[model samples]
Target: MRYMAAIVLAAALLSGCQGADKAGVNGSSPSSQPEVSPTAMSATPSAPASSSMEEPLLYIEQLRIIGGGQLVQVKSNIDIDQKSLEQALKNSLQTSDPETEFRYTLEWESPRFVQIRLHLDENSVWSGTFNLDEAVTVDGRKYASTEQPYRNTVVIRAGDGEGSLLFQGVTSGTRRVVPAWNTGWIKPVQTRESVAPSYLFYGQEKHHLVHALTGEALEIPVFAQEKDAYGNDYGYHEMYSDRFYEDFTYMISGNKTLYRVDLKGFTSKKLHVFNKPVYGMSSSPDSKRIAVLTAHDEFIGPGADLTVLDQQGKILHSRENAAFISHSDGFLFVYSLAWEDDSHLILPADRDEHNPLGQIRYNTGNGASSVMQDERITDPLKQDLKEHERQPHNDLLLSGLKWSPDNRFAAFKSGTGAIQVYDTQERTFTFVSAGTLLGWMPDGTLAWADIKDLVYTF
Candidate 1:
């Protein structure tokens, strides 16, 4: 079934006499300027402008389109001819099927602008804008200007499918293209009281830690500056806890050593070192215990072990080959570790033919393992996976499924690079923009990096 797509165009009217006199076009005086036919202006009510003036300067102010369960709003200030505005709207609002019929209504938003609402029965819509100031007439067709600034700038490009906006630093030359859906302005919601302290590993060599909330940085004196076989530099790869300390955060270095860094003093203290490389780490909700996963090598395979350590790095429980299982492909890798509570560690097991994607519950108190049956945790994980599969494209990476400290929301990077937060209780997804998930602040706010800056959203 096709949904009705609604398009609303807002146009601002200026003094026609002044605009025409300034242009001095066709050797016509303001008094001799051609009048817009009543038929051309019949659909729209008379705009609130100077009735004494012979003409009114018209420019598209904003365009809002709603259809196919999506809404796109574009803001611009491009001049357009009144006689051709109706036909231009129709041409730009056309769907894939050329025969589709549509209608529009005009509403006066203010004395300066009028809103044109176009309604169509279609599944998708594509629209673009043109700067009519520099347009040229060719065979009765108006071609947009090819001038430098106007030609390079895209006033509006809206569609039902995925789109992105490229952002670049004015002088730094740093560039990032985020999903266009995230470009819409939204009022920040006050949903949390205190945010978890978040940090990001950023620098030319990624050997520096910057606080996500504050613009503070600390150089890791002992950070592993080595490179992998693939020429990828190794440093701090993940931030384990943002809720553990007020002035410190727990992070794992590339060399398999964990450290607690002071966010205020800008110092680092070695916490513990794993014998093998660390794949994943999770701190208990109480911040008293830490679960570390280590494997024989960096790549996923056999010989994966799980260790429960105290805050001082003393081992409380150890299990060999407990995190993964062997399969035809060599091993079913287990990662994305989190704690269901202070006593139970939850591991999302990799899917295999014999077993669907499931979770393993490791009891820290008894050192026993079993299939996770807690509906509270399993249900949310299952729902999150189901939503991930429903995304249009599946090839994109969907990683970093971290649960909120309260276990109410699960945040992950969707296929389109947008950080989607899934509410376990509400069973809904919130697009938090395109970036790397940098864990959550204690107050339920999410922290992420958009390659250019650290973004915090709730």
Candidate 2:
């Protein structure tokens, strides 16, 4: 699955252009000129962005702050070539016109590692690992990462004490304005052997298949556990999508009896069990109601298929077939819920008529609903733009979509570990997080996780 994701990512990065377009980065005014050529140019899509400024950025590599500096770490299956680094370091080094000092920047030459910020110095020739956070140690005294340049030298040169000295660039005091991740996942006492390992909630739980280094793959249920119960604890339950509520999401649980969590119920009383024990669990868009698959029909007569209960664990509106449910009543197989409009609820489910397995919006009012997102269901939608949904994908077969914090779109991982996002309203798609299994918030915003052994956030 990881390999598949890597391939998909590679193809996506090098696909040229789908139909006919210019080869530009999100069409940022052609580098050169469009020219008098008749053929249209293909362009690279711009990097993904969210409306919220606080969203944590998702990087293909790890990001961190260490050595009192903002440094980036790189990893590679191949061996690190010190000779190559020396050559690169030699080329990266540069001095001012006056030739008072040297300034060479050495960007780490690895691919699989992460990015973190570390030390700074006079002239602060920002290292490849320098950015956002940079520490300064004048006279051998370690100081904060924020330090100014002096002596016309733009770098510290990582004296003999330093293991490796890379080239450098200009130093900066401005730190990146990224959201702070949750820290609860690690706070709890956990061990390496803990089951139901805690998780991070960058956005919310989403289903893109997961793969291990051993080449084993499975559509595992994974997500960031929780961070201060953000978004009314929805991050622990839902995913994002373009169509307000129509999206794919779900929870992995053996206990199918419990439906809605009552606010008044507190910890113990908060647990609300459904009258009908079934396979799926869903929540209402309003966060006021809950819906569960009633057992009355599956094996018996005209089954009272769905049960609707209020936040207080009281029955509100019980319908025969809750094919149409409100935010108060989430959908089956969907760990999350969204709102298409005041009258409709967007849920991720498998519909026969629209066999294409994208997100389907059900009109709870008059049962008059349309397809909110069919494109995600690669195979099911058959790529029929004429139809309300999109044809599902093949290599990447993942489900259980979730909305992000900003409530803009939905995201999920495919069987191959490729992560995709579907606009709720525009019905278009934009790639967000991509890996063996895109866990945490589907939107890719950073959140914290408590996996028993460690509590980390991204």
lDDT of each residue in 212-288, candidate 2, tens digit only: 11112122233333323212221233221111111222222323323221212212223344444243345554455
RMSD of 1: 17.4
- The C-alpha stretches of model 2 lying farther than 4 A from their native spots are 1-265, 270-275, 294-304, 319-342, 351-357, 373-415, 418-458
RMSD of each: 17.4, 21.1
Model 1: CA > 4 A from native: 1-201, 204-243, 296-303, 325-334, 352-358, 373-449, 452-458
lDDT digits (tens) for residues 214-304 of candidate 1 = 4344453434432431121222344334244545556666536777767567567777877666656777766788888777545646446
Model 1, position 250: C-alpha lDDT score: 64
Best by lDDT: 1
Candidate 2 CA-lDDT value: 0.30
Report the C-alpha displacement of residue 453, candidate 1, in angstroms.
Answer: 14
